[model samples]
Target: MRCLWLLGGSYLAAVDSARLDLSQVAKDPTPLCHEDIVDETCELLSAGRNVFQRGPSGKARVLSFGELQGALHTTLDSLASYMDFIDLDPHRAGPFMVNCMELCSLTVASLPLTHRPPAPDVACYTSDAGVVCDIDVSDASFSNISFDTANADGTNKFEHSTAVKVTVEMGNDTVWSPDVAPVDPEDRDDMPENVGLDQLRISVANLFRIFPPFELEVTESKNLDDVSDPQIVEENGTDAREVEVAIEVSPTHSPTDIVGSGDELELDLSDHEQDDAAVGAGTGEVASKRKRRASTDGEDSPTKRSSGSVTEAAVTAAELRSLLGEHLREIKMAWGDIQDRVTAVEKVTQGHKKELKVVHGKTKVLDQQMTAVKAKGDATARKAEDLETKLEGLTSKIEELGIKNQATGDGSDPWGEYLARRKEGQPGRSEGGEERKSLSEEDQRSLILGGWLADTKRSIIESEAQQILDMPALANFVDTNRVVVFGPRKSFGILRFKIRDGETAAGVKARMWEVVNHVRQNKQTLSSTTGLGDEGRPMWASFLKTPEARKKSAMCSMTRRVAMRLAAGVKTKEGAYYNEDATTVAGYDVDWSTGTVWSGTHKLASASHRKDISRNDDYQALKLGWVDIRAVVAVTGCDWSEAHEAFQHEQ
Candidate 1:
């Protein structure tokens, strides 16, 4: 019974062995392997999920295993719908389609692929018959093939050159359920019930059945009687001559006696002649006695000829049947031998496949290793190229400097002393050492000055930065503060004090340098300056260098007026406390019980507003060279706001 699975169902049909044609089916290019289908279904599902997960929120959520499985089924159904053929039937469908449906149905029952992870390893291969799928994708086609042709005995006749060691296991669900706990590799069994393996075997068998390796067909057809005819022509084209000779003598001999002999018996023409004479003599006496013998001889001749024809026909039919039977038996034996060979070939192919699988696994491992090695090699090559470039630049600089490679009169290379001292390094080198031996006087001075400037700037900046960071109130004024050192130009090196949002550039610099100079004079590190942030200590003392009389005279009249107002028990506006004119500078205590205000001889708000204007005064003068500083720029974020407001007020 031949059954084809098509359109989601199996259909059975009776087909003639001789008339079964697979030519049209073999031409089909459709990929119906179970593994291919599953892989495509998985890929499609992943693609759809990626599409659905993209959102304006920029959040991508991947589907869970159950969700993915559902998607997989949907994808498969969609693919099948598009792939369905209207003209396809049991006879019209290819073997690939039939076997794919059969194998996929069986596999789905066992695997179901429920809760399977994404990217299941699935692959397939094509053979003459149909597609063979390795759902687990553990193997590939045989890489190196060889046959043991010298085995005269049929044992291991087409076996692989190498022996394969295959270990099987039972009672392990993980072999079938890969997403679950893994099977113990140490477990052993001769034959295990592995669903994937069984599916593969069934698929292979079906493939072979659909496309057999060998076939026996009738080259020519003829009747048994036609086969019995002699191949070569007889002499004179007369078959009747031998029959006539037999009829003349064989009346006395029994036909049944001659047919019984199975040995090599030749016809004796001499015995036939002797038998004919004896029969003729006996008949001669009867003829003489009767004068009517001539009439009787003529009447008996036709009857004798008719009996001879019947005997010849019987002999020919028996010979034809015997020959036909022998040929048929030989043909059956040959066919049985062909079947054995096919089975052997199939076994060899299976062994090769197993070995090929091992090779494929090794190849994948090798490819991964190669990828990692290539990445490392590329990184190392880039580093080497960069190092080479730097070396070339340094070499060119050295050449431009005219530094000779020759040994000095003291029997040492010019750079040897420096190299030796460099190898035995210290925290700080001596001024008299070979450290600057190769440098000219100016270069040596520049190197020394530059190092000193960097150290100085680092120490000063560290102190100032620490102060700003320690005083959280300073955060309202300073965004960033650091020291930048530049140049050993011909003479002196420079250290630029940089500050962001420092409206009072000179005042900030004056304060910063004071801390730096104190540290230098005291021979103390930046961490030792704990007095810088003291409440009464003034670090910006240089910004306050002004005439004492002018500072006192600016607000003396206002101070006196505020004092009088408080003395007279006058109530002052709340906002007037911040006025530079000092609306009420005297501190007074109110006596509510007596309904009177008592005045104290002191100021409420400073009449000069020294805290606000002192820094602004110094900042204005710093632009006119009241302070000696260079490369200092205070980038004020509110510079325009302050200036624009002042302009508006003047207008």
Candidate 2:
């Protein structure tokens, strides 16, 4: 049987007979010579002198078709068993794909036939149609062939019908069974003789359960004897009747020039065994034991040999046994030495393991120490942060004291000056030493406000005041020095000053107009607003245009807008509205009748306006009432002191 393995895909079925290119075989006629085929097959099949003779020395011999079939079947079974050891069930693994193409190639290449083309010589993939396998061995033919189809000793019909059929055609004559359906060969005529047999065919069905069973009958017989082996039909375990299927010659042999058997080959072992027996004369028992060992292993002993070749093989087997025993002794001695070394190594390893345990203990102790240090470092870091915060606070206090000390002279005081004037019976003094009469608090406030007009550049007392009063005369009030001032209204008393050198009612009216204009302009732009009730005027229009307030030039409306901005906060129980900075009172009131804008009622200033100014260093100073002109004068007095020193040096 010449089995063509179907791997990867159904290539054997996919490729048609027309697509096969057998031209190379036709052109060459003999791809491998008879001698080359014999040499190649020697490694796999049993070899005999007749099977491997040189050219023209003797008749050429070939392996019978039954032997080839048995070799291929046995090889396949061995490979399947090997795959099982590796847990690869070939049946379940599906068709041999490209992944196993290498394994398939090796298996095919290892077959004992030179005329057989290796798998790599043919294309395995679909992209290329490769050379077809055409094994022809009609030239190296064996004359002596036997057919065995005896049914097994069973009454089972399946076993009775399961048989292997072999046929040979010799020059236009079928020497085996003719074209016929299923029949017992026992009932047929004897196999034909006196025919020059050249081509031999063997087919097996149901040899194994995996392959589908099939059979073939004798078809046409031709005079030409150059038929190559056909692809093996798959075995599909069934009892179907046989038919006339195509057949071919094997690749391992040539035409019918000889007849031989490859079973009687044996190795000669007598010389080595005799030498061992002479060397160990007293070891007759050992020799007998070896002979018994060979027998137990299913090998024929010297006494059991039936032929000269078998006797020679038995002697060679005895020599091998003696050599193997010597090797075993040496191996035992080497293994004992290895065990001693292993024991010493184990002792060293145990000592190392104990030292490692000690080192691990030390490592754990170091880790604990590191953790302790880390905890201490964390506590120290927290302490350092606390110290940093305290230091920052102290630094801020020092800086505040420095700025205050730099601004205010040590001995110069505005309150002290007022006290000195009162003690001297001089309520107000002129530069010419005239004893001025004491003025009302309202008049004093007007004087202070008037002084602020000249000092507006040096102070921010009215910085939040909006330019609401747009009267031209009010714009010139600063130049005229005709404003009044009132502020720093403590719970016990109020402060007032006057700078009465211009028309007080006109300055007041101009300021009122400015306030009304600011409210009218910024009714929507300001953050919030209140106290300006509906005076029958549009929100965008000047409140002074209302019929009732027009008489006062909208002075009442302007006053209300000012009061609303100043008192923009939640009112306290004392009727005071505190600003967002809870310590700062919202605002104070203005007594326009006396031209006095008083603010001391809530310790605040009744500035004409107070916009929602952003908190910045300069504006914050003004908001905190730290921009008093007295403080400005005291800080700036050192400039005059330096000038006096310069003048003295000039003198």
Candidate 3:
């Protein structure tokens, strides 16, 4: 009888020899016995656990040997429900199922087990096979199996629990005893009796009876009597008498030996022969027999033969030597021709080497020319930078004179004059006293929107002020006091400064333009001073725009405020923010809605009232400078439409 051991759905051992006597196995603690097998299996399981524990975060929860054995028992019991028993007889199902459970229980009992941690009571239900106990191992219930050190600690130790539902069924009925208590390893007196060796032998016997070991035999055979008949042919035609022969000459043998004496030359017919005379004499007899047979069969009778034969012809030693000499002469002539071809190839190779040297010399000259051109290019760049510096100095001087003349002549700021003319409904004039062309309302609005505000809070504005102060050409002429920084908030702020002493606002603005050009040219200096590295946003300094431009910007800010407020309301009601097209207030589009009072208050509720604005449509629109003023007026009301009231009163 053979023995097959299966564990965890895989074959553990397959012994083809005679089965061991259980009586002897029990008397002696052999590795083949059931008790030793269980111990070996436990050792393997412990090794597997150790492997599973290793990870980047360190070892997982370490399970004691007893706890691991208990988990194995529980896992096997659960797997029994899914086992296919179609190959077994249903009539013997009671004994077969009992043997399976007994075999599993006996193996687990043999282990030096310990009590597992108290597991939550599992709820089971009856299925077609039996009752199934289920413990939810979902991520929500059990922490996800993680190797991340941050998530792998004592708090997540429960994630390694081996609790599983066990299903035990009898013939056509579910058999589970609620009263049956689990084995207590700590209390030896309370523990169930250890299975005796005789009981273990009986369980093994029943297991083999129910599930016999598999065997396969293969054989091969052949028949020797199936032979094919040979065919006989009559030779009526005459055989060809011509014979072709070849002679091989050893390189060590002398040509004089070939011509000196015929007796010295020997003919070799068989390649395997050590002696040339023996091979020649044997081959000559065979040739004589074939010739005699052919001559006797000619015209007198048709000879019948089952197979063909080989015939050899013997040549005189003198003739063989002559043939060998002719072959040697041809070989010498061919060798001479090969030497001539090789010499011609060497000559062509020498000519190619000479050409390569000439090309290499020309390459060196081109490299030298490139080095000289690069040097000239560097000198030209230095001269261009010097000319730029001189031009900037001349421009600064010219602006200083213009500001002095303007201040003395008018005693009025150019920007203030321009605003005054607009207020009086008169045409404005430029700093040069030239009348400016009339602009359309759209063109005027475009200018207002495109220009920067005097008190705008933008990082670029602050960065520009830093760049201007850091410049070597302007640093001495314009002090920190002259570079007045202004804004509603800290950090990102505005800049306002006159370029020269006694400079009118127009002259200061003109000089600022010239300084901006210098700043652009020295970008590395500007970036370092502003703390705006190469990867940061672009920066430049300029004179402040008209008040109208500031008002337009404020209006745009108000529009964004209204839109943001509407988005907040939508988010609060629907639990999600929406874009401008989807936002609605009081059953109307948010962009066209009038202000609505809060439910508990009579005062109007607007976006400005809320401090936290989510990154919704309005927030993104503000970043891109796309807020609409009409939407602001519709939602905020005309009372707050004026730039001064909206910008000043609201934060």
Best candidate according to TM-score: 3
Task: List ranges where model 3 is wrong by over 4 Å.
Answer: 1-329, 332-339, 357-372, 375-379, 382-390, 402-651
Stretch of 10 with least lDDT, candidate 1:
284-293
Tens digits of per-residue lDDT, candidate 2, 1-651, equal 122212100101111221225575456553222344333332222222222322354432232222232333223434344344344445332232111222222333333343234211232211113322432212111111111111132123224233344344433433332222334545443222111111111111001101111111213222112222122112322111111223221222111111111111111122223222111111111111111112222333223333443112112312322333333333233333444465579779999999999999999999999999999998997676566546655664464445334556576555677788888887643335543334422332222211122223211332212232234533543323221122221111111122334546556545444534544555422111223453222223221122222223233223333334333434557865443322222333444322222344321221233423452222112211221222111222223333233223322
Candidate 3 residue-wise lDDT, 1-651, digit = tens: 111211111111111112233354346532222443334323332332334333354432222323222322223322232122212221242312222333434433342222110111111222234422232211132221111111112233223332333323323334332112332334322121233332232223222111211111211112211111111112212222111111111111121111111122122222223222211210111111111112222321111221221122223323332443343333323333443465478678889999999999999999999999999997886576566546654664465447445656756455676798889877653335433344422122111111233344434444555555566786644434122223222333333343355555466545555555654665433232334343533344433444444344454345445544544443334554534432333423222122222311122233222312442332212221333333443443333235223433454
lDDT tens per residue, model 1, 541-625: 1111123322333334322343343233322366333223223433333322222222333222232232234344322221111
**TM-score of model 2 vs. true structure:** 0.17
- Tell me how far the alpha carbon of residue 202 in candidate 2 is from the true structure, in angstroms, after superposition: 30
Model 1, C-alpha of 522: deviation from truth (Å): 53
Q: Let me know the TM-score candidate 1 reaches against the reference structure.
A: 0.17
Better of 1 and 2 by lDDT: 2
Cα lDDT, all candidates = 0.29, 0.30, 0.32
Query: Using Cα atoms with residue i matched to residue i, what is each candidate's TM-score against the true structure?
Result: 0.17, 0.17, 0.20
